[model samples]
Target: MTVTSSERTLLDSIDAQEIVSLTTSLIDAGGENPGDTEEATAKVLAEHCRALGFDVRTVEVAPGRPNVFVSIGSAERPGVLFVGHSDVVPAGTGWTTDPFSAVVRDGRIVGRGACDMKGGLAAVVAAMAAVHRAGLADEHPMTLACLVDEEDTGLGIRAFVAESEQRNYTCCVVAEPTDLVTIVGCRGAANIEVEVRGRSAHAGQPRNGANAISAAARIIGIIEGSQAELDANPDPDLGPATWNVGTIAGGTGTSMVADRCVLAVDRRLLPGESAAGVVGDLRSRIESAELTGSGIDVDITISMEMPGFLTSVNHGLVTTAVQSVIDARFIPNGRSAGSTPAPNGRFAGSTPAEFTDIWTASCDGGFVAQQMGIDTVVLGPGEIENQAHRPDESLAVQQLTDSARAYALIATRIAALPGL
Candidate 1:
């Protein structure tokens, strides 16, 4: 698709420095999970959106947590929605600099949530502002949803979905770290807890007690064996479902036989799998095991579950997003927009390629796509593997600038389509 003069003007209006500055301020605001600081982040975002001549409001999801909504153009029509989370994981130890300082070193923004995903959030804000400033909002309406509690249990998105039952939206774009790729599908996730009970006795006479730890071990073995079965039937895009034994605890002391044991497991699901069904199947398997008549009791429960989503690769949103990235990479001056200068003064990692892939990790996008029946695509600025939740988390400055341009184009193209 060719870039029109109006779209070119809008893209050129995206200020790189402004995006970087806002990203730094957001990182410095410090909305860490397990902490009540998302309010601060929401304030910063609302203030900025208001300054851009847009309608901004904050809806409280909890006592202190709020989701910020920024609107451009009329609410009567179905618009493009940009979804993002304001909360970031807690910054653990082993950093050479302050985690909240928002340092810019070697063309990268170093901070706690720079990559996953304050940078992406800032880019979305910048894109919306640019579109509004270009006098295109009336034709290309847009909304920015800055959510909360995404790192923990997804309370903010749930609240938004509940209130949005009567609202109209064409599609959604979740601003998560995807290394600039368009993610068409993501794996769902669930946390399961298992408990085992047996008779307790002194270790001096092992045969006098039914060992609970031994019974738990048998369940763990079953879980490990199920992985092979899942691997045999993998999804074409999102891959196979798998199980992980995250944590396990049993026994009090070596002098006594254990009577109780607990295990925490993480399960990744395919698009059509349900957490309840998976749990039921596992319970049935455990009940039918040899331990059923061996004087042992077993219990299973699901602590959390997030659904997965799959969008067609041929969808207009996906193709538009890919083209937007390609267009954003080339400027009028024939120089790549997001090229980083190497130590020897040459460009390093300049050209941006189109990559349509799937995400193994779950996100708030699943909730929007599955619950609201909206087509959702995850695309953002940073690399999740090396940048998210690490000691010195950071993202490239050029990526932020390019992402803003790409998002602006996506909004314009999607809104202009007929029968959307």
Candidate 2:
């Protein structure tokens, strides 16, 4: 493939300053989940798409939150869906700077959503613009779906998948801060709640009550035992299926035997593991315990579950994304000078390399691949370890710029491929 001056010019147009401006505007809006809406943020993003000659649609997922879906090129052929979310988690305490400042200081854009992932969002939008400006939109169909509430319940992506099932999307590329690596798979998450009930009795008469706390303790032990066994057989790429007892509460007072105890569990599922199977196994273990049959009531319930997703390395999307990352590395001086410092053994600079892996954390890719059945790959900018949900969260300007170029190149290549 020969690189044309026009292509180089368009790719060069995706600079750090533009991305930083967009990201700063977005971060300044403070679209935090559970309270704030993304309407304003969506509007900011929509203006960029409209200026790029892309058709933009806003679907209200909630009162003030809207999912921004933009389309470029022809829909008659199979297209690529670029998935991202605009909402950020609440800016918790201990921030030296304003979390919503979106300030460019020390070569990084500091803000709450700068890395996790308003920066990625800006990159994808800019990628689409660059592709269109380079006349690549006519080469294939492209759709940019900016979602809401990815930090909490994934209602935006879930709703988009449900409503757009009939659309001809062959694959999905998610910009999820993979440090510019192409992610092949990600662990799913299930939020489980367990309740153990017993008759309360006076603390002075310990034996009079079938201690619910004791029953809950046994349940916890059972989970720990199962977790150990599960960890023994870890996935080659995904490591292991794991579960943690996140929260437990029981007993009202020191002078009383606790009558009820509730445990909140966070279960991380491997690619092939089903939520039902894991929850069933836990319920069976609790039921089989001697205390359960001895007047203790053990109830298991699944509060929420997000399925895991995996794409074959041989898939067209995966291969194209890998090549795109490799291509992004050659962009001349695309990164800010001395912008990124190596943190935690991970390369801090934007110099690209093949660092594909199954993300240890969960994301909307689960819903896109598992629920929508589209081959989805998690590829994006920024380091997940140090930046996400951390104080003074920032995104490297170079990473953001490089990610846009990669996304633009990948979209063009995927568009030219034969239909699935």
Which candidate should be chosen as best, given lDDT against the real structure?
1
lDDT of 1 by residue, 268-345 (tens): 988789889988988887877777456578888888888899988878788778778767766533655355332123
Q: Which pairs in model 1 have colliding backbones?
A: none
Clashes of each: 0, 0
Worst 10 residues of 2 by lDDT: 336-345
Report model 1's TM-score to 2 decimal places.
Answer: 0.93
Q: Which residue ranges in model 2 land beyond 4 Å of their true spot?
A: 1-6, 164-166, 331-354, 418-420
CA error at residue 321 for candidate 2, angstroms = 1.3
**True lDDT of residue 336, candidate 2:** 35
